[model samples]
Target: MTGPDRRTVTSHLLIAGMSAMIPARSIAATRDPTARTRQGQAKGFVRNGASIFLGLPYGADTGGARRFRPPAPPLPWQGVRDATRPGQRAPQPGIGPLRGPFADYFTGNRSAEIAAMPETLGEDCLVLNVVTPAVDRARRPVLVYIHGGGFTTGTGLVGTLGDRFTVAEDVVLVTVNHRLGALGFMYLGGASPDFADGNPGMLDLVAALRWVRDNIGAFGGDPTNVTLFGESGGGIKVSLLLAMPQAQGLFRRAIIESGLYPDPIAPQVAADQTRDFMARVGASDVAALQRLPFDRFSGAGTPGNLPVADGRTLMARPWAQAPATAANVPLLLGYCKDELTLFALGQPALFDLKWPDVPSRLAAAKLGLPPEAAPGVVDAYRSVFPSDTPSDSYFRISSDASFGRAMVTLADLKSGQRPPVYFYRMDLDTQLPPGLRAMHTAELPLTIGLSPRADADTLTKQISGAWAAFARTGDPNHPGLPQWRPYRPAEREMMVFDQVSSSGPDPQAAPRAMLREAIGSGAQYNPL
Candidate 1:
């Protein structure tokens, strides 16, 4: 069957099981429940005592004129919308042999997940998934999550499973879908008046937040008490949102994991990149570019896309200069140990290099420490990690450049503000692959309590509890776990989350200190 017909068949099959599985509960009953949306009036399941509304449209399709532009509101429908199943994924450019331990994480389980993905590309990609404990009118705190994929790939559905937070903390969890890559971040600053801006993906996020602020009460969530949290690219998006004026009052708290916004692309740089991308695709105008095949716009050959400092929407560099508007929002920021290990696994050349050659290679990329700090940085790392090899140094260097330094930089900057700042180092290793280490995104399964292995259950429970507690209250401190103190300049206390969690002054002291000094002193590492 053709794409459209296949989508219709899939939608029909998904909706068929909705009625039998989702029993309606009375509004006044102890188990408060309600309909999904006006169009897809499908009832939600009471799994683990929480009601879920899946694939609820917050904005209309981005087809034709709508593509590459800001998201538009969904059209009003006649009846309850069947929000029983997930909506189609945003159109992604297909390309390359997927690399690394997390390649499948991005390509998704094609046979299982993408087969159910919506087939057609359109303006209708703006939708959200929500899980809440009750549909009563009582307003519970809400957590709006944005997923991460280096600004090129990923969906909210893939990273989050809201059952733990919703049922455990009695909070509402909302995950949103937004434009990515070229469609999201193409800067048209000098090209056209209308397209003369950056961060279209971020704009989509703000639109989703606006929807939450306006309509979340209907789903038993408080519009005013919202927390924005994400991992990797999602975390970077949160950092950008923290700096955005439009997103200021929409969220009260923020959690950033393995990402920060210190190295936003300058507007001129973004425009130049856009020019190069257009040249590659043979498109002279926005209209011509939009008309190209969606695959041509998205595939592996597509240029890297990220939020740009457009001067208007994005007022200033987020990590470098704190937005005056976001100065007061409480922040929980952190990174996973061995974050770059997975990314480095895909590039064997990095693994083959000699330990002594590591510093020179970094210096060649302008990411070297000052001559004074270079030997000390290497020595400090080696002193702590006696058996460290070139591969380990590669992981350490890349991790610090892309995620670790960024995390510390943001924390240090934000610590000077009013609202308290907290940080952690996630050391939980996964069972997926040995070489993966405590790689980036490994903390996700644990934080969301989705790990299927019996061995990981204890860790999952602890981490999930901490996250839920933080969602419920601004603080992440729980009863059984060691006290996770706020990140203060004096003590610099950080929680080390592992099989046996601990809290003290900077566990990775030598590496963290060396990285902080190196980056502060003009080292030029690439931000992932």
Candidate 2:
């Protein structure tokens, strides 16, 4: 708990004594724990009964010419590679600890969790961390988690959550680190032949799944029973993978939590942004752009730096059509009720917003709702949560417009396919500030069994049990929780996770209808 925060670590590294930075208590040394990956042997350690492996590379270094292209396979190594500590994260814009009104909300007011954010970063960041009951061939259900940072920041290190999920659920927990921001998603096909393949960030995930398919068996995982799950940006990645051909048969199940990007950047828009980026960086040619150090422009990011609907890697936008290719994969998707509260924390005015200002504020949020229709949206939301304040209603309305509607559309699109679809909405109160009710990422720690609240153990058992059940079979329903029904248009049933979880039909009907009327489409505006 006394360890340096992310900013402090970076500051120490910036100074000359980085080599002398204090380290955490080391794990007891025992050379008996090992796993043979296809690339090479991995030397891990035993902790609380699980074999923990950290920082195993699934792809080659993506620094110079390989920056914007498809990932290459990691070369084979001769001897055991040490995986005792966390791996390097992809270079991202902000590498410091957050210090504002938003920090408490994002970190759940946990100093240890904030300090656990990995400090080391580099371009060769396509690594994964694994925690398993053992390295034997037991064929446990594999749960691969992708971290969320809005396609910009974050790494795959699972921290305490990884060990908890692995041991409690008896599953192999694998967390991955892929390219973020410009390095992973920037479209350069319109500029040169070498960068024709866009969405290298997405490609990095596909490569990781392939690695799981090939090498996970050696680490006591059932390659055929891999379940892909992520939250926020990581959730968006899980959603995008459903439509990708290369990611088709890599996994058997998918779970998306608050990760709906209704609008991926268009190819032309991505190209325009690429040109602007080149000009801003003063690089006239592709060669010059490639030569610039990653830190020089790691902070440069735009909306255009998202996944592109290029004809090849990604044929169309995710959820544009029924994922016919992934028809057999059962899906579990949902979002927090107050999804936008985390983003709203930094703004003081939002806390004191009045009823008359609701419409303008909603319109200003740019959730694709027309300005004239804002009043009707507010009225609709008021009808649902009759006692909510104007500020509370504003947050709920905007969250539904951006996240709730898209999740409904995706569930609708994936409905009636060969495989079943399950839906839910996280409504658990975080016991934080009053306005941050069931804020974004509140379900993560609880579901991963690392929540600091002593009272959350019961709900965590039910939630994490459902996830493990889904990974084991196709259904999320288990004896520990209520009977969760597959989503059907007629019933529209979804499990609502809270202090006392229950099944419900159309929890946000009024506001959903209003947003659909206003925007004419159910999907738009994904803010991470």
Candidate 3:
């Protein structure tokens, strides 16, 4: 892994006597193998007996005029494209300062870790990675993973757990990176017609799907059977793709894990973007906004990266209506038992709450519940979980509000229709820190074989079995788990996943009423 003795390679030219910024090991390890993607031939490396291709471009340069618009097809190349080095991530704020114990979760401390993170950011970020048992094999189910960071941060790099889905699963795993924040989703309709319904970030995902449709076969995948699966923010994209007309027919199945956001793209972003955009880049007009350096414009992402309903690509906000476009696409939706604690516990009061502080703290938590609704929520939680403390109750209530409700609601909406929705809940204990049981993103490493505990492997095997079966047949039922049932509006049925998985009635019925009353209609919060 020494940083030495190398050559420079760009899209067109390479110079001698210059050091290759990528590690020397990566350069030598991958120089022998090559595969033809739709855009061009890509050079790749090998790991764990799998062909590991990194940073393969799926769209053209997305800077200057191309900023804040749908992605253009990648420019075809004359020579082989070098995909050994990690591509630059979309520009957004990376992890800020952290406090005690919890900092371990963000630092990526897995023993079977992937390679390092990309050290730079750029607008040329619409690239994807491919990991296959062998490019020579054909018709294998393709898993196109959308990395989570909402409409903003996170890349399809090693940091996002891309390498974990390699040969072990016998599916071609594809991870993608696209535009984020202002450069990807800020609405500037006055600037141009193309930028009217601003959701360039979502469009980037659509383009990536289109790329998969055309080129995944070369990597030993069945493009017709692509399964779009993601976690956290990535799961939100999978849900959006299901409702988006532009994303129709690109894939056949969807899996959403702990993703929650409002269904429709917001009609108008609450934050004043016009003033912020102008202030950040020293540009008052869309014309001038295009001329500013992308780094400046993208880094100054304020008001967050929310998708706008421009009425063309998205007719209504995603998830608001039954997804007619995805009527025939089977869906598997689930969430971790204590999904919100990873984020909720960051508030010191919630890390461990005293019984006396419970009342005032629950109200002030501002979980979108009204003051009048707080007492009822407290009462219901106390009745259902008698032995639980205030902190435990808050964690469970927040989990149901943010993630659990959405899973059931979407499942009910998609049930008794063209394609069925199967629901599950991950309650496995990895025995991790803070003792927040089954916390958010805890299943990530386990599903990909990073688990150290013996109890986790059984659930991981069942999960992997279900995911693989779903990718192949659009149904997740297998002998590994109990008799899983498809969700129905009239009947409450869901699979509770653990060391010994089994079926049960919808677990949210009682808590949901309280949550809806408190949060008004239903709860919605974009995972940060």
Candidate 4:
């Protein structure tokens, strides 16, 4: 079954670019549990004692000619805006089929999550939510999260993380929704000079940051102390924003949790996808394309939405190495112990493979190495894990090749930065099948202060505290954790979070090196 096919997805405004956008007084507006903005007023209710504001517009609607253009400024209203429910998610192909019996187990939702989503997928999808404990605090550190989906699926879900993140940590929490899929990122630049700016989705994030810089102070946050964090695709975005000059100074700190460094799609690759989109929609020109309804454009069978290096919104190379411009920004990077189990456990195709099949399968997908080198990589992992079955070896190597390499590469890039870059490995095994141990996104709900449980109480306190401390002071050295030294190339140190949590030096060094030797430097191109 295809993952997130044709489906969905969705920062900060640059301080320099947005100086005259919103007034300075707007930053210090009084918080009455009800707040006022330059555009209008919004009343956020209390939940578990935290104030909550849901679905306030941060950017203008994307419809008609505005579709696929850089996000426009939010249109102002005459009356108070009612921010009660979540804003509509970006238009997307729904998460398609799940083949295996335990497919729902892998996703952690049988059908309940899809059932819970709003029925409407609207065009005006640029809105955001804020949760604060008390509006009384003058300078709270802010945590603004961009939801994951690899630029394809996931919404900026609304919640009251206030009890956990805001009240306990005293940091404000903000979640945002931007455009996604073909709606936000269809590359029509070469064909239509009018649509030349390539990264509209990234720009949407910039608009949200602009909103935060001008408005978050009133919600009890410091616009100057904002830290952007996300897991998976969201984490990828956090890293991308770090390199973006347009998003510079919008966020002072960043946490990249299990995110791959996405290289912008090459021009021909984007052109092919655009050609497919145009053919599917029967549009000959960009004007005719914009005239079509959103549903028709949304339905086009196309590739996953990824960014492009048009030299405007993004550099020619997308994080080919450490980002030179944003190297000064403090960063925390990490991934789950079994990052791909979130996908692999449900994939019988991988689990059911025989030893003879592994080489051809790896070659077919070009997972890490060519067919001739697959045996060497398999042996490499066997030397590393030792006890795992052949299938387990395949999955582990794939995980390392994709996400694990990205983590180490980022650590390698930022090894000596003075501002400091931190690294971690989440080894927390779950109650699910052992093969699904510490799967992707396993740390999200608790780490961000979602559902609270007595079992996860200690874990939550530790992980959340590290995140909170990092946001507050750029160092995650709270009393709860081991002294997490800044990652270094020689030692390759990283904090490993598990039941018996501890810090280790070069935990996966042997395996990462093995793959690097086999795949060469091209290993950095592995899609995370």
Indicate the TM-score of model 3: 0.86
- Backbone clashes in model 3, listed as residue pairs: 148-234, 197-310, 263-318, 264-317, 264-318, 265-317
**Which residue pairs overlap in candidate 4's backbone?**
7-93, 8-152, 8-153, 9-152, 9-153, 11-205, 11-209, 12-209, 13-209, 13-210
Q: For candidate 1, lDDT tens digit of each residue in 215-317?
A: 7888889888898888877888898888888788988899988884445678877778878888887889888887876667675546546677788777555
**Could you give me the TM-score of model 4 versus the true structure?**
0.86
lDDT of 2 by residue, 148-264 (tens): 777777766643334656787889988888888888888888888777788999999999999999999888999999999888777878888888888999999999888775356
Of candidates 4 and 1, the better by lDDT: 4
Best to worst by TM-score, what's the order? 2, 3, 4, 1
| Count of clashing residue pairs in every prediction | 24, 0, 6, 10
- Per-residue lDDT of candidate 3, residues 85-107 (tens digit): 77766776544222222223322
With candidate 2 superimposed using the best TM-score fit, by how many Å does residue 403's alpha carbon deviate from the native? 0.9
TM-score of each prediction: 0.84, 0.90, 0.86, 0.86
Q: Tell me the tens digit of each residue's lDDT in model 4 across 346-436.
A: 3557756777776676666555576788777777667767877666666667767778778777777766566788888877765444345
TM-score between model 2 and native: 0.90
Clashing pairs in 2: none
